[model samples]
Target: MLKKQFKTTRVFRFKRFARKSYSVFNSLHKTVTIGVLSGCALISAHATTVEPAERVYTQTSTDSIPPTELDEVVVTASKVDLPLNLAAKQVTVISRQEIERAPVRSIEDLLNYVAGVDILQRGPHGVQADISLRGGSFDQTAILLNGVNLTNPHTGHYSFDIPINLSDIERIEIVQGPSSLVFGASAFSGGVNIITRKDPESNGFAKLEGGMYGLFGAEARGAYKTENSLHSLSAGYKHSDGYIANSDYNIVNLLWQSRFDINGSNLDVMAGLNDKKQGANTFYSAAHPNQFDDTQGIFASIRGETGGRLKFIPHIYWSRHYDEFQLYRDGTPDIPATYKGHNYHRSDVFGMNLNMQYASRWGITSFGGEFRNEGIMSNVLGKPMDDTIGKYTKSDSRTNISYFLEHNFIFNRFTLSVGGLLNYNTAVVDKFNLYPALNASYRPSKSLKLYASWNKATRMPTFTDLYYTTSTHTGNSNLEAETSEAFETGLKYIHPVIKGSIAAFYMKGRNMIDWVKTSSDALWESRNHTKINTKGLDATLGLDLKEWFGANQPFHSFSMGFMVLDQNMVESGLISNYVLNPLHYKFTAALHHDVLKNLSLSWNFRWQEREGSYVQYVDSQPGERVDFTPFSLLDVKASYRFPHVDLFVNANNIFNTTHVDFGNIPQPGFWLSGGASIRF
Candidate 1:
């Protein structure tokens, strides 16, 4: 009955809009009349149509008579594919169309508008950033490329150093709660999975862009497909002169993917490389103004899957990363007592994963196991020794194994899922651990659903947390694993013209990790907090005016999202570095419209209020605590389409707002870029 109400309401709304629009578009009299007649007929036809077995939502395009319903499937929430409406956890899907329409140049900018996601950047154009979810630390989140883990073991700061360019991505799936039951330890807070395109049609594109601060870049992508095989390649290069002294950067990325279908089986292969060299002005220490860094990442993977009632997927992946950092510029003279040396670090991760799924009369069951080996070779980390000159020559390696199982039970309108993970690590004091989760969803009606989940997760300390040492920082190797218990509940409503959801969650953390210091002059030390608690609320609403008011309307779509978070440390009198960087409130709004038949415009806005204070340092003066101020940014994009080419221009931070996402790091201001893409 609820589903019928939704359909009727949408039809009535569309009828009202159609009748009122006849007078507005008198210039195109014949076109307007035909549109109204067709809209009414479609509404009548939709009213008489029968409900299908599976739920589907038709996404209205700018130039379509009747919307076509599509099955929205998701795979990250569980190990197996399920419709978004049936998923037990909160999931956000950013489709390829949405990605291409936005004026974002990097994955970081693309995720900035999502509710409950915080992207704290230290430089422009995604030079570096820390991704946090729901008040969790950066290390708690996991990053994946096509279901293969890409998390760096050395530090979470490099977790977003993905090798794929924007043109290579098909979609991004964000799981917004504890996902260790499906992924592994790094997924303690949440996870992000980027899916690449594998279309069977041959296509290619080339784009060139240049803008403020001497920013310029070029990117190209091409794909070839045959009946039995598909291949794709993408490459990009970007560079920028410094907005200020020693703030310049050069970035390069390359990716290749291939898939082959043979004998009722599918095999996929992927290889990628990312290299970046940038000026890091006061990135790590305020005392250093001419810092430099060069980083490179290489990743490769092979995956094979067999199709049947009983399915199996086997995968293996390898990742290698190299980092070189200089605290001072090359021309700077090394003083006797100053630390002016270059640090070189290398890390590698090799992993194997096997997944299986079975469909039976009772329910769908899935299970998986993973084996991983990771190691780091650094010039200045690990156990200190008398023979070594302030550098550890030996590599530090660790081995870990994890197995997970999940069972989904569907009966009538209710679905229940229970899962658990058993993990073992050779480096931990307790080498074995167990995590459990339970989720339930109730579809009161086809258009509305309610769900709740509870899960437990744990995270191991990173290499930086265990062995890093510097004049102003120190790390302890005796830290315990951070653990948390999370609970979440949400309600979702879906309709032809409108969709929305509201969710509330609470997390309790024990032995939470943070870098802290008691005094301004003391060295920051990595330690574990006794207790921490966080609670938050997230809400999102979207409206499709094109479907309701006809595509000729000036305003076609609008969406808004908001989040509120409150975090507290139960322990008394502790100053932290990363844990205290949560935002108190964040709000995002977006609007899209067609100004003309061939031209379109879109605008996005974000306002954020962050909690806590950071230490601000002046020249030869004592550091002072400065409360982070609230800031708002507006970004606008305009595009004009031709027969085979599309031209676009974007203005970012149009108001030239002066803001700092991190301590003493200034963000770009009033930047503009224009580009054109030609498709073949």
Candidate 2:
């Protein structure tokens, strides 16, 4: 219930500041009342208690709370804001009703049940998606939206190709490991945060969806409240016409959020706009069936926040992208100068973030700081190529600074935390970096917890990895700055009919930024020599069984999820034996039942497997080939509920399989969908 109304307003402001510090320490004498009774026994021993099946399913446990249940997540990987089981790392809370019951559209379908994630989809709906975590690379997994920093000043090659459409998410907190210490240094191979959807106080909603291969969509959200203020607005639109052969798409989004309250201090504002019209297959094959290319983009963002325990946030942004292309060699179009070309990209971002927390009598301390500035520009138009031409503009600027500190020692059943992070970066022409990190945590009980961390991160080599095209083999202006150091450990668990987590990780990278193919032609360039070693293990499991089938009103539920991953790069000349480096295994199962009682039942099953071959490019004659194969997939869904209205159905790759999550393009066979939702 609004997280127990924000935990009873932070325990009534910590019991009115421990009764005004024990009445000014008993009028300045009486030995300061034993330091105000040890700050009132550490705020009543960090109060938090509410069992009895969450106080008897306070407000219905809808389907046993397993829609990727995230019991109120808010973990900044220990820069404070705890919860997610006292965050000390290993946080995974993907929700928005599990992105609408896995209707995940993009962001690799919302990290397919995240557990050491690794996704690489080659085609279908505006193709191009390469996401990796624990197996880092997809530009070393460090993406954020809502915390802004969608990385890609061009050529970090991770632009899941537009469409963040997941119906304006309201959650997605994945802090697996090496968060580059409080988000910096490009996460080094971990950290994904995107929590949007705020400003809701009253009640308002809107939704519309269309399906099938050429899916269509619409959404509208509203919220308003007074007594101080709170407002919300959301908008969405989507289009697609792809299932293969040069995919297609169009997307638009607009969101606004606001909050205001005085006397307890609170202020928030957020704005957004994103527009895109995309269709590019990077020239698909089977003899290029009318291969076509196009791209258009526009973006905007503004944010501000300030409330309580030392807080402040500021942000600004702007973006523009446009591209027009045609290159038909076999599919005819009679090469009119290779069908003409044009490209333009622009960007600007400004930032500020700060937060603080403090609690006394020997524990709880947090600190923060952040500053950023970035600008980019790229422009190109028409002919001029024998090897390459000109008019390609470039402007680069960068600035970022960070500082952090943390502490959270609580005894009596464990609770210890320590942290550090300091980063400073500047670029306008390379060289100016300083990074650092350290972490720890341990909680012997309270549903178990244990953690560890070590960090050092950096990634800076974009501008098309130093000035775009310089033919014969792309540009590489003496790149350097892809550094890393990672170390990790994990374990988490909670109970009440089952909740879970399991983890293990290791990462080591150094100047490891690859893409090198040069022996006179085959053109591919971007380097930092290379050295990468990653290890992984992730686990998640859930079950409720409707409290042992004794259900009358706790809905009914069943769940299962599993994942495995292994990645490598032992650094033995030229990016050691690449395999697109992602050893994978995934499985999922879910069942929610009611059958009839307002009528609702849902079933979802997914399985994915791959064990080798994922290297996209590599050939200095020492190999002479490229690869991508080994695949398997499946998906399905169903829903229903009525009182106002709610009905749904879905099936994807349901037996009409035709797999290939990447390479050899083919996926999106057997597609069916139905939708309905109306509530007032």
- Strongest candidate by lDDT: 1
Total residue pair clashes for candidate 1: 0
Sequence-dependent TM-score of model 1: 0.88
TM-score list, all predictions: 0.88, 0.30
Any runs in candidate 2 off by more than 4 Å, and if so which?
Answer: 1-76, 79-84, 88-90, 93-107, 110-173, 176-180, 185-190, 193-244, 248-405, 408-422, 428-493, 498-543, 550-602, 605-680
Q: lDDT per residue, candidate 1, 332-365, as tens digits?
A: 5654456646887888998877666555445567
Clashes of each: 0, 0
lDDT of 2 at 204: 59
Q: Per-residue lDDT for 444-560 in model 2, tens only?
A: 765677777666676666555665563323556667767767777777777767777776667777776665543323455666756666666667777676776566764566666
Compared with the true structure, all predictions reach lDDT values of 0.76, 0.54
